[model samples]
Structures are given as C-alpha cells and as structure tokens.
Target: MNCLRSILAAGLASLVLFPAPVRAQKTGEAPGVQGSKNIRSMKEIRDEGVVKQRWDVSCGAAALSTLLTYDFKDDTPETSIVVWLLHRVDAKRVRSRGGFSLLDLKHFSEARGYHAEAFSGMSIEDLALEKTSVIVPIREKGFDHFVVVKGFVAGHVILGDPGFGNVTMRVDRFQTLWKDGIVFVVHPPDDRMIGEKRLPVAARLVPDESLISRKIGVTAPSNYLY
Candidate 1:
C-alpha cells in the first residue's frame, strides 16, 4: 500500500536533501547523556520491570529486518520518541490525522495516534521530509534502533502512483552509499539496487535489541489506519 511506501520513503529519503522540516511531536534527535555521544555496546538504555529475555540475534525467532526496531531505554519509566519528517508528505486519502502516527509499541495507551494520508501535504515522490525522534522504555537507557540492509535478489514491490507494488515488510536495514552520515534501514543484501550503489554494508552486528525486551505486538495494516 502507498501508506507503507510513503512512510518508508519519508523515513529513508536523505539527510542532505530532506532535513528536519517540522518537529513531529513523537520523534527527534536524541541528546547524549551529560553531553556525550560515546555510548558503549550493550550498555544500559532503559528497563520497564523485567530481566534480560534472549541471548543472541540468531537464537531469537525474529529474523534480521531493516525496519529498524527501536527499544526505548530512557532514564524515566516513561520513554518518548521524536520522528522527524524527512520529506514532504501529503497523501491525505487514507492515513490517520495530520499524517503522523506515533504509538507506544508496548502498552496500548490512550495516546496511540495516527496521521491522515492527505495531511502529509507532499506526494511520495516529493522530497518533503521531517525528522522524527522518540524516547521510549527499553532495558537499555538509549535509543536502540534495528537497521537492516536490504538486498532484492529476484522480486520487488513497487510503490503506487508515484510508484507501484512494494515490499510491504521486507527491507530490514538501510545503506547510504551516495554520501556519509546518512542512516536508514535498507533491504537485504540481495536487492538489485544495492549493486547500483555498490556500498559495503555491515554483515552482522550484536544481538537483537527488540528481543531484549518484551515483543510488543505491532500491526496496523503495514501503514494504513484501520
């Protein structure tokens, strides 16, 4: 559906072309603790009343995905996420209110929100973007995002209108070859587009941060509101 594609596009457009347009209440750049960006691996991010769950990424049933999962690791029990729009969005046909959907993956709080399709303002092809950042509750006290580099070996899902058919839930990580300091979860290594850029993406990382905490069931028609 275009909703997923649009959401996906706004997410990985490009830092240079699409800087933070407007501050999406639920997403923003994370500030370092005491003014420090140096965070060690497996360090404390956030905890919400439990012990470590899994051992390794391979051990967990969850497969490697580029739809980077963010485990909330904030000092306060309450975590927040600030999602900045990376591109102009205006597919108001069938999205939630105001083209913003920010919800807590863990508990079903009254705050569960959505953005309308027409609210985004710009089409998927347009380069309008917003920088969204959110702080949440993870055993670790920082933002643990799951990034996957996607590779299309044999098939593809194209976006509609602005594009068509799309990989609704395939891309796991993002690899930015055109420039540096760009971050987005790309598709698998087999994707044909990866070759176009021919960038070297990291093969493996530590374990699954999502597994470290309780797997909060998240399903919303990929990107459409029920």
Candidate 2:
C-alpha cells in the first residue's frame, strides 16, 4: 500500500511539473476584433489613392497630382506642380488669393498633353456618368477646398481629398457643399484613339492640332471613375 501511495504521488508531481501544451488558434478560425480592425485598415488604404497635400493652399496642385498619378499613372509629385504653377503666377498672389484656379489647372493639364475642361451648372447625376475622375471645388466650414471626385460607392460619394486622404459624403450633403456645381474633367491623349487604327510613327509624333478644335460633349458615365 505504501509503495502504491509513492507511485500515485510521483504521478501527481509529474503532472504539476509538466502541464499539457495548449492548442494554438487555427489559421481558419475567426480573428475576432483584431481581424475586423485589419479589414477596416485595408479598406482605408485601398480607398485612398490621392497624395495628401503638404501645404494649406496646395490642394489644387495636390488634386491635379492625384489625377495624373492615380488615373493616368504619371506619378508627378505635388511639389513639382506647386513649383510649376508658382513659376507662372506670383507665389504671394496665389497665397493671398487662395491658391490656384480651375483655369490654372486647365492650362497645366494641357501642357501635359491632356485635354481639360471646366463645366459649371453640372449636377451630381451628370457627374455620375463621367468615364474619368474629376476635380471639384467645394466650400466647407467657410473655406474653399479642392477634391478629386472618384465616384459613387454604395450611395456615398467617394472623394480623393488632398487635405484628407479619402472621404465619403452623402449625395444631399455633397450637393449642398458643391454650390455652383463646377467640375473640371481631364481627358488623356490616348482616349482620343480608342477605336482608331494605329498611326504611323511620323504621324503619331506630330501633335493632333485638331484636338484644339474638338467640341466637348458629355457621354454616358462609367462605373469606374479613375
């Protein structure tokens, strides 16, 4: 009996000294709060395509940079745009007058071989049909700012804001802030050759002078904004 008690005690002591290993969480199992947080972070990163503005008055440049980089894949830095615009216009004047204008952005786009147009009195519904992204100026909290309107997603207007990384707004709220309904649309040079036959190297090298005379028309909007 004493020998039996000694064996039982040794077994209990071994158990106390060495507990069984715990099972690790499986890869297929739900990650709970951490997984949800990771998903939200990914969504934010996917939505933000625009480069954030470095200065307060650089939103216009930043917006244009976003379009060039994100839409056309130009990858032009925002500072390059600011420097280019400031070279043409007085830097102090720009700062005092509240930054660059739509006309300035239009000229910049043209210089980059892109056709740009500004239309007033356009509605959100009209914007919904645009094939490419557009830059819009809005008044919020008594301040004028520029943002790249990516498009509608699930009933919210997705914007690639220069000041803010990415933002979403309701249709009604966006309309109120949009006020004059001004929109600036930029068309890449390649868009003009959608269905056309390939041109000879010499012909392609020559700029399309006819583009200057091309009439601007609105077409059906597409689901993809950029």
Candidate 3:
C-alpha cells in the first residue's frame, strides 16, 4: 500500500510540474434507491430535470417508507454530492413518515469510511486531501431531512452496476448513518394489516410471530436511468 501510494504521489507530483493533458474516465454512479416521494415511478425513461427522488429503506418504522432522487444538469464524473437525512414521524399520521439525509458529493470526491479497508481498491479513506469539502446544513423542515456525505464510490453504487430486478422487499435492517459511523436499524415503517394477510413485521424491529412487512411491496425497475 505504501509503495502504491508513493508511486501515485510521485505521478501526481509530476502532473503538477509537467501539467500534461489528462484523458477523462467514463461517467457513472452506484446503484441506489430513489430518494424522493414525489416521484410517481422508478422507470428508466429520460433524464428529465423534474424527476423526484425517494429511497428504498430495508426496515422502516411506524409503517412508513421513503425514496429520494437527484437530477443532474451537468453531473459528470467531476461532480460530487453530500446529503443529510432528517427523520420525521407523526403519531396521528400513521402513514407516510418523513426523514431526510445530507451528503457531500460536490467538493470532496474521495474519502474512505472505516469499512473500506477491506476492499482491494481505494477505500473512502484513501481520498486525496487537496479539495476537502464540508457538509452544508440543510434544515429539517418536514418529518425527516439532514445531511449525508460519502466519497467517490457513492455515485458509483447509485448509478453503476445496472440491475433489472429492483424490488422493494423487507429486510432485517436498513443501513443508516450516524454522526461518524454506520448503523443498522430494525424498525418497520408504519403499515396497516388487511384482508387474509396481516402486515408482516420487520426483522430489524423485532421478530413478531404475528405480522411482517411482506404486504406493502413495490417492485421498481433495475435500470432506473435508461
């Protein structure tokens, strides 16, 4: 690792001194659920600026779910973003709980999370310290909204590795971000039981013998941006 870093450092140093023309790489982001509720569907039709965003949380609380999306005017490989999540829940409105997160994808394009140490490639930690950005404070207006900042790999997972089997399924937990670490939560989105089938309980919340989150399911397209 040291040798690789030294070699990269030397090359970058030479780039500074020589300032030669550099070819650009392909543009891509990672595979992520939409992060907006206003969006009617998650089909890959066009890159219109009007597309709303929502996120597919694995486990939700109080019978609720959320999705988020972002429209790019000039979001090439050079662009980065930071998002903040604000969680908002209402006792009266048992449905449609609210929460939002913030991330920094605009300035800092390379940084590593602690877990990135496992990957053979550059972890979020290996980010160069030339252009460090801050997580802007976007106020929480409704139920949930805040800030989330990730390195270069964030967009990769959201826009890359195209899949066709996107399904809104229940899981033991939906991943979350704390102040400086990652967290797994087992809370079910507030949902009501109906008919012969009851609302399945979430494994993340607790194993209930009676209900589960299998009833409220949404199957989205794998390739959202076609």
Highest TM-score among the candidates is held by which one? 2
lDDT of each: 0.19, 0.60, 0.18
lDDT tens digits, residues 1-226, model 1?
Answer: 1111112233232212212122123334466634334432221211111122121111000111111221112121111211112122333411322122222221112222222121222222221121221111111122122212222221211101011111112112211111122222112223332223211121122122122222222122223111
Position 103, candidate 2: lDDT: 73
The window of 10 residues in a row where model 1 has the poorest summed lDDT is 57-66
RMSD of each: 19.3, 23.5, 23.2
- What are the runs in model 1 whose C-alpha is more than 4 Å off? 1-201, 214-219, 222-226
Clashes of each: 100, 1, 95
Q: How would you encode candidate 2's per-residue C-alpha lDDT over 1-226 as one tens digit per residue?
A: 0000001222322222112232334344364633312222322442356677777667778889988887777788989988887789887667555677777778788998888888888998888888767888776444566778877754557766665455556678788878488888988899743232211112111111111111211121111111
TM-score of each: 0.18, 0.66, 0.16
Candidate 2 regions exceeding 4 Å error are: 1-47, 192-226
Q: Residue 3 in candidate 3 has what lDDT?
A: 6
Q: What is candidate 1's TM-score against the reference? A: 0.18
Q: Identify the superior model by lDDT, candidate 2 or candidate 3.
A: 2
